[model samples]
Target chain A: MKIEVIVFGMIADIIGKQKIEVNNCSDTTSLQIKLTHDYPKLCQQKFVMAVYKKVITGNTNLNNGDVVAILPPFAGG
Target chain B: MLTSKEISRYERHIQLPEIGIKGQELIKKASVLVIGAGGLGCSALQYLTAMGVGVIGIVDFDKISETNLQRQVLYNANEIGKYKVEVAVQKLSRQNPAIKFITYCTQLTNKNAIEIIKNYDIIVDGTDNFATRYIINDACWIANKPLVFGAIHKFEGQLTVFNYKKDNNTIPLNYRDMFPTSPAVAEVPNCSDLGVIGVLPGIIGTLQATEVLKIITGIGTVLAGKLLFMNSLDMEFYTFEITPDVNRKNISIEEYLSYDYGQFCISESQNQINEISCKELKELLLNNRNTLQLIDIRDQEELPKVPVLEELLIPLVEVIERVSEFDSSKKIILICKSGIRSKLAIQMLQKKFGLRNLFSLEGGITEWLKN
Candidate 1:
């Protein structure tokens, strides 16, 4: 399955602003693994994934129309 | 003029049924201590002052730098080289003459954190570093004062209320519940490294100020058990439900003072640390006494190249895979777009190559241009 990954913070700097659609994603949780597989640069950073504004762990299931976000650790105070 | 001033000054706030006269009165009587006069603190102060928060105490030891002006809106061109708290007090005072502001131009450490926090009914942790954030948390927890916390990164921010006591138990999760362990400094980049959008703090800081008012007035669903994580890129907010474990309970002042909060979160000594300014590097280059191998470890894409006469290029991420390219005997000076990645590179190189004469330029190329 293909998924759209939205990046923020320093992660955006690596992936750039454009949303990338890639294959090998089974669900919202597995999308991170596939994206990092496709783009090895993302593997270095720690992130939490969200599906439609709710944080989803590795066990979360996803569907076709869900929006997935890759949130990185914040630097602001 | 006076009637119009009263009506116009708080027309938006007074319109809220939850924040009418009684809530506004509570705001007038509230004394809040805000730690760090950086991005979040500056925004929090702006709203609190405009809302007529009676007393605001600002704690920051950092002076205004050219870089801070981007997100720290309270300071401007004229305020450069001035103390943040001193400058913040002047600007915020001008914004609302009715409110009283206190400035503490000192660092919040284990030694003075408690006494500094005692004067306020609520505390806001706008501090950037892990050490300071944990210190503020412990200080607020010990004092039994409610905390309005806000943090921001490149395009993301998190806000939460901690230690707000209700009956026999406390409300919401403290900082510890959210982050049981601190990410290593190298793992997480600072605002300078990541490049925070200017308007991001304005959004997060206002949310923090909103929480502070809610805490004062005892109204609204305060972010007690949940952490509100917002991403500005899409303007999305995710409220994560945080459950406090046994660690949140039985926290005492003695436990706080005795513990090394930094070590608790980050395990491992940050080694191979060396820093010099770009101006100093230039002098050493000219003198020819240092005999240093200046390694430019930044990505080739990052530019406005360093002016060092002799330098080698090696991006930080590829340093390990390409370590054999550099000679171990030579004294090395690492370089990156900013000083952060260079420091991380130095740590990695030391573990692989052992400690040779190595140093990094402080503030990297960014500071070099200024000097």
Candidate 2:
């Protein structure tokens, strides 16, 4: 299954792009591992993951063409 | 009863059926306290004033900088050295003469937050730090006032209303519900370092002001249980529902008072290492403590260097690899631009080398420069 990942805020800066497509990722954990493996800098930052606009935690299952977002809380005014 | 002059001045607002005579009157009677007169406060104050909010308070201790002119629309080049709230009051008063403006030139602390916020009907958090945001949210919860929250980062912005009550028994979700605890400071880069588009705060702040107006007039759905996220890069808006956290309930004032917001937000291991303030660091530096070893963990590009203190430069990213250079026997002090990176560096060093003599400079060089 392929998942479409959208990154926002500082996470986008670290990832070097707003959107990316990852292959063979079936759940939030696998996708997180795949992302951290590809971009080591992501491990240093804190972010929240949302699937289909709903924030999810732990090993939530992901389906084909699922849209995932990596959002870091913005502290700026 | 509005005078003919007042009626004509608010004619556009009066013309709208949703905010006609009664709504305008309610707006005129509403009291709002806006914390931080920076980017968000500048826009929030303007709209709130234009909408005829009877009483508005501005709290900020910062003086205007030339950089602030790009986004803090309330200040101009001439006002660079002036206090933010003083200048904001001058600008907002001219924008709407009928509204009363109160200025607080001091930073809001646990000692003064609840007392000052208790008098206002609504609290608008225009602050840029998590510690302050948590303080404001906790204060609002204790005071039972609705809070209008706004935040911006780069091209993205977020807005939400917390603790808005429909009745006595119903408890709404708050900042803690969305973020149980403040993110570690190193994980969150401030606008000063990361940079924000000048108009991001303007848009978010105006939205916050709009939420306040809606709450006052009882005309629209408040963002009480939802978080609105907008990305200007794509102009995509998303709202996510937030549920109340049972563990965050029944917070007492004593807990808020005892909470080390600064330490909690910046350092993950508060008890593991010693933390020194800028003043203490300065004193140690002045005393020429031979046993003290200062290491600046900030990137070389970070500005406002400590010219007065002699320190070794080792960026946080390089700390793990360069751990062999430090002497664990010496009292090690880590410094960074905002003190956050240094704390992270200390944690890294402690974990990698088992060095227990590490200490992070609280507030970093930014606080050092101020002193």
Candidate 3:
């Protein structure tokens, strides 16, 4: 399955882009594995993954055209 | 019951059918505890007070800095070095005489989060650090109070309400549910390091205040079980529904007390690091000559740069990443605006690099220049 990914905050800075496309990403856990494999710095940073418009803590099935938002915790007020 | 004067003051709000006299009374009865009187706190506090929240509790231990003027509009140029909570409460009290302002001029820690947060009906987390954010979340969850959460980075802002009760069947999501772990202290940058547009916090903080108002007045959909992301530049708002993790441990009071929240900010263990007095350090500098390395681990903007010492500048946050820049073979003295950050820098050096050649200057550069 192909998925569209959107990154925010430092994650965008790390990945060097706000939007990207990943292929054969069947689930959120595998997507995380593939993402960290390409952008290893993400492994050290803390963030949450939201599929479409819902946040998921564990592995959830992903379909084609699904938008995955990589959101990191913001410390500034 | 609102007095005639109170009714006249909030006449516009009372005129609205959704928030008539009954809603005004509910607003007057509600109390909100806002942690951290920084950018978000300032913005949220202004609206919350103006909306007639009866009791407003503010918690902050930071002093007003010149840099803060860009974002924390609560303080004036003359108020620099004064405690934020003191100035914020003083100004906000004048904004609403009917509202009672409870000022806590101290940092919110594990010891005080529960006791202080339990007193208020809702918790507004405006803290600028991840450590305090988690502490606030855990405390609010344990106390069973709704938490209005807002945080900003550059032009982007996030707003959410956690542990909120609505129609109540499925449990509400807390901060831990969204981000289970904290980003490494060294990797994360704050407002100071990465500049944030001043209006970003105001926008997010006002949204947070709105959530608090909705929670109190029982109107509109509160931002519970979802995260709202906004970009000031693009003017876009997107909310993501959050699902709870069954595996995450329940945050208990005992677990909170035992957890070292300070590990994210500073050292918690006994101060085993060596310390040198200003006079002694001067003598050592004079005798050791060029052998010892004098490193000022404070932000460059900090005043009274020691031209005589010619210390190397490396801010505390960059200490871990810049460890290779320090020559561990030589005796290195770290100096900061106050002595606290220098000690933390030294700890970082020792912990990350295992370098024992580090020493913290007693009283920091401010004391050193006093003589």
Candidate 4:
């Protein structure tokens, strides 16, 4: 299943855009692996993944058209 | 028990049926402590003072720099060199003479975080660094205060209420549950160079004031377990549910005191050295003590000596002079009192001789005693 991944803050700088589509990602783990492989710099960044607007702690199955938001902690106020 | 003058002063708020006289009184009786007098603090303080929070505390050690003039609307050119908390309290007092203002000019440290936070009914996080953010979150968790967290980066901002008590069925989410660990400095450096839109903090900070008012009045649903995301470029707002990390256990005062958040964040980006936890080190020592060289970086006179390892003693100051003593071919471990100095030792070795076989004992001997 293909999912749309949206990134915010400095993660956008690493991913080079606000949104990117990943194909054939079955779970959150694979999605993260693919993201790390594609953008090696994301390996050191601390961020949370929101699958369909809900933050998931552990791996969860992803369906097609899911919007996964990569939210990094902003060090500014 | 609000004075007639207070009721008249808050007549606009009192007239609303939802707020009424009781909610207005609640606003007059509430006390809030806002950390950091930067963009977010300036905006939040303006409304919190005008709206008549009973007593407010301002914590900031920064001076008003020329660059702050754009977003921090509270100060003028003449006040540029003045302390932020001093100027903030002065201006806020003038805005609302009824509300009390307490100022803490020193930076918040672990030693004073709990004592200072316990006096206030609510805490506002407007800090700009990851170390202070983690400290504030842990301090609030220990003090049992609800934290109104707000952060901005470039054109985006995040706002939420952490550790707020909700229904019995739901567990509230704290900052740690959202971002378990602080990001390395490489991932996020000083934001002054990154640049945030001048108005971003004003908008997000005002929203934080709204949450505080709602929480005090007990009128609207609070953002307890929800994270609010805002993107100024797209002008869109999205809400995400935050799940508590089942593995994230409660932090004890002892554990909180020993953890060096500054070093923790820096250590990750500092050469990315391999760390040996106390538990892991203990298991490895049982078998690999002869194979691994353990070096103590503390002074020889330092107490709590572990004679079992038969470790070599080399003070941090003398590590460079005795560089030849370490056998890089075998795995080497550095031990210190708090584990912080050991990291410095590893960094020193990597920089001088480019040693790759160095590991720092996590939490040092203090953690070993606990485990």
Better of 2 and 4 by TM-score: 2
Which candidate do you rate higher for lDDT, 3 or 4?
Answer: 4
How well docked is model 3, in DockQ terms?
0.64
**Candidate 2 lDDT, tens digit per residue, A1-73?**
8999988877888888889999999899999999999999898777778888776645689999999888777
In order of appearance, the predictions have TM-scores of 0.79, 0.81, 0.85, 0.77
RMSD of each: 4.7, 5.2, 4.2, 12.8
lDDT of 3 by residue, A1-77 (tens): 67999888878877987789999989999999999999987876788899888887678999998999999888899
TM-score of chain B of 2: 0.79
Kindly report which residue stretches of model 2 are placed more than 4 angstroms away from their true locations once superposed: A57-59, B167-171, B246-250, B263-296, B300-313, B316-371
lDDT of 1 by residue, B266-294 (tens): 22435437787877777878886357788
* TM match of model 4 to true structure: 0.77
Q: How close is candidate 1 to the true structure, as a TM-score?
A: 0.79
Summarize candidate 3's per-residue lDDT along B1-371 as a digit string, tens digits: 99999899999999999999999999999999999899999999999999999999999888998878998888899999899998998899888877899989887888878999999999999988888998898988899999999999888889889998798586887888877766655555434556789988888889999999899999988988888888676677888898777777787889888877754333354257888899988898788867788888766675777887666888776788778889777888888765766766766567767788788888777678788
Give the 10-residue window scoring lowest on summed lDDT in candidate 2 chain A. Answer: A50-59
lDDT of 2 by residue, B231-298 (tens): 99889888876667656555699998877676333344646767898888778777857888888877
Whole-model lDDT for model 1 versus the true structure? 0.74
- Assess the local accuracy of residue B235 in candidate 4 as a C-alpha lDDT between 0 and 100: 92
- Ranking of all candidate structures by their lDDT, best first: 4, 3, 2, 1
Residue A4 error, candidate 4, Å: 1.0
Maximum-TM-score candidate: 3
lDDT-better candidate, 2 vs 4: 4
